[model samples]
Target: MRKIPIAETLIEKMLFIFTVAGSLVIFFVIFYIFSNGLPVLKASGLSFFTTGGWDGQFTSAWTAAPGQEIWRFGAVELIAGTLLTTGGALLVAGLLGMGCAVFLAEFCPPRLRRPVEACVRLLAGIPPVIYGVVGYTTVVPLVQSLISDQLALEMVRICVLDGTSLLAGIMVLGIMITPIFVILATDALETVPLAYKAASLALGVSHWRTIVKIMIPVARRGILAGGIMAAGMAAGEFIAMAMVAGGVAFLPNPAHGLLFFLEPVRTLAANVFINSEVLGKANMESALFACASVILFICIIFSLLAQLINRPNLKGGRSR
Candidate 1:
């Protein structure tokens, strides 16, 4: 082999160092959050995860009393809200994004595909704050109006007096994550060999049947990976969610019937954001750090899931 250039060798070493540095940074962050938060979690015990209600003043009082038990720092509602919004967002994004992806991959004319795809990608580039502003101004008012009707309000037992609610958060997050699904699913679909589609068609399968049975199955791994990523993003979304989630830490009352979505809620990420300023006050900072730890755990779980789903099979090839 020819001798490598000095510049090339130096560049390779630098890249390896940078890669190692990035990984170390991630680990350092996880360690820092856990170190700061775990003691509070231990102190709170099981109640932290099982109960709902966060009174900073009460917690501060309790913190002042050294021997008194610390209670009311629970995060059950935050967890529930995070899950509800994320699940609803996934459902909405899945349906709409997959449909758009299928249409773009199979039906759109060549000339139009570029422009349409560009539009979807543009959505991914839009800042989360913009989505928050739009949701606060438009979706909130719209939800408020729709639920304000006497018959609808009575039937659903609307809990919120105005627009900011779980429904608004879900809608905003769904819209925010739709572009992720569209882009990834479109790429996955496009990667399915044309030969697969042609073979199915040659065997007397209809175009729709070919897509449903052949192309989609072959591309499902990418679609699922995209979904996992979207879920993580939805779970950790702050600004947009905070703007529309009503900023209250309370479990959605099932007694509200179909209008439970109208109830105000606060996600774990929102909890950390809303309470971030109380760094040295009571146990608030520790509690917020705990919320952050949970969020980090959730992100880690999603990442692991994506890795498992995307792992190559024993045959040394990706699953179809």
Candidate 2:
């Protein structure tokens, strides 16, 4: 057996202790949530999962009117609404974000890169509430006007899709998440060794072609990693989504068909926010906790996915 240095041994023990402490903290929190949250599920049975409505009071939420305090809970609608907005945001963000990252890392002049990257990162630092406010004040009105004009031109009946809609939420969320995508993905793209770039250029490969064929493959995993991070952020986002998604706990109106994008929605995080604010409601508390538990599980899954995506790089490094 090889002798170990005393200092190195102490560091190893310290690291192990820190890891276990972190795990125990997570375990305790999860245990606490589950223990407190399961009572609602037991009382409601499968009906809680089946029905798609929220019949709780939101007296404290200034943006929403005071709703009835009747004790009732179901997450189907919330889940649907949340998924619609979050997925829509991801779709919008993914396209613009990936393209921006590619251009910033590969095509932009070296002199312009820093300022542009700084502008994108500035977005990431802004408070989520600011994004919500901006979306509500600006994007919502614009969307409403455009959609209203189109319907008027086609002689379609006027719908009350006044700014606070699934479309607005998607727009706000996508914009907020884009910075995350650009920052992480740009780092990944830059990490591709210069030798590979030089070799491809020397071999008469066009700049765009080499980037698509060589650099992309090497950095694909990291780009995906950025997407996963952005997805997690979008899913957890509440303030902006609540502001733009009309604070209704239902799917888009099916009447308009494609106009569903203009419908109001309710999300899990927003539900938690509303319900948690109302005191003296044990059942609602438990139900909201259940929603929180679900969101937590989703976050955990995204984290695991990020780790799995990075494993190929890890394995390759070890082999080499």
lDDT of 1 at 38: 80
Worst 10 residues of 1 by lDDT: 311-320
Per candidate, the number of residue pairs that clash is 0, 0
Model 1 over residues 1-320: C-alpha lDDT tens digits? 99999999999999999999999999999999987788778888888888866755335644575655353367888999999999999999999999999999999999999999899999999999999999999999988886656744554443444778899999999999999988888888888888888999999999999988888888888888889988999999998988998887878888867668888888999878877777775466677788899899999999999888888772111322
RMSD of model 1 against the true structure: 3.1
Off by over 4 Å in 1: 56-72, 149-159, 314-320
Model 2 Cα lDDT, one tens digit per residue, 1-320:
99999999999999999999999999999888777768766766777667764643323222343463333457877777777877888888889987898899888999998899889989999999999999989998887786665564553343355667788888999999989988888888888888989999999999999988888788877887888889899888888887888887766667778678876787888877755665446656777787887777888899999888888545211101
Clashing pairs in 2: none
Query: In candidate 1, how many Å is residue 157 off?
Result: 12
TM-score for each candidate, following the candidate numbering: 0.91, 0.83
lDDT of 1: 0.84
